[model samples]
Target: MAINLVKGQKIDLTKGRSSLSSIMVGLGWDPVETKKSGGFLSGLLGGGGGGADIDCDASVIMLDENGKLKGKENLIYFGNKKSKDGSVVHSGDNLTGEGEGDDETINVDLKRISPSIHRLVFVVNIYNARQKKQDFGMIQNAFIRLVDNQSKEELVHYNLTENYAGKMSLIPGELYRQGNEWKFSAVGEGTMDADIGSIANKYA
Candidate 1:
């Protein structure tokens, strides 16, 4: 079943018959532009920035019982590996922003997680490709969803573009579990330059 989660709702995983063995987190958004055309010459000559374009890098984190990182072993980050940053690894940065295929998918093996794990966090970063200061209002249908692999169910869904900030962020949704299925919802919508830390602080 597809579960639509609103802000402030909590899903108690321990109450479920099956203690979340694994979780798949998917980040998706409506692509602003499908293709980019022309060059600076075409623009300077009278073309202007061709087509609407939105590019981004995103990541996810898991919070342990003590409200600290479960380390790289418990988390999956996607995007550029710039400056050898521990969490900068990305599956692939989508430039087209076409909202197709898997923009960002993080698979967590619950078996590997210590019993101490308490929450999961998601973060999305918009690259500001156009270098313009715009808010999430310019975007549409952006969301984060958690799925159960065994039952093929959508455990939780969060609609963010309605009231989220552009740039780096912690997706304001946390998933635990409820009645054999995980549950989650947007908690507090806020923007931050630090994706990993902001997420960790929620449980901390």
Candidate 2:
């Protein structure tokens, strides 16, 4: 079982696990059906002219020791699925939050990552949310977890159940370096700006 983490909590993954080289950060979420005040059939099916498949995308931003963006290519998402040095790789994009389990999985190799890169931040945003008028408020069961790839054991997990109506982006957590040790932090923060591009621009 994974550790159900609270906001602002920190976990040191590299403490006892000397063999913890690779980890899979799995993210999961489900869409909340928007109820409509219409006919019986419309209400039965929860039909809504506005409701549609919410496309949520997960991304990883590699930052230097000073918490600065290394480069644009370091931002891994559906657009750029792989990192430059092949240290970090996003599995793929999850268009809809329908399927069971993680919507997006990001793989990180401790050995492959550059020493200068201090942190890898995990972010999720609804694709074209401004056009869809969607945010985390309408989404439920949103979570991000870290696991030991080899052992198949979940190290830490955080489930977000907050009302983020006007926000479109979520800063779930981050994997950072503590001397030779690596640690994970659960940060469930939200932002109102549109897409991932706007969020990335802030760091650039």
Give per-residue CA lDDT, model 2, range 91-158, as digits (tens): 99888888789999999998799887999989999998888767777677999999999999998989
Q: Candidate 1, which ten residues in sequence have the lowest lDDT sum?
A: 80-89
> TM-score for model 2?
0.91
- Quantify all predictions' global Cα lDDT against the true fold: 0.54, 0.86
Candidate 1 pairs with clashing backbones: 12-177, 13-177, 43-48, 78-90, 79-90
Error of 1 at 201 (Å): 8.8
Q: Which runs in model 2 stand beyond 4 Å of their true positions?
A: 35-50
Residue 3 CA displacement from its true place in model 1, Å: 1.5
Which candidate wins on lDDT?
2
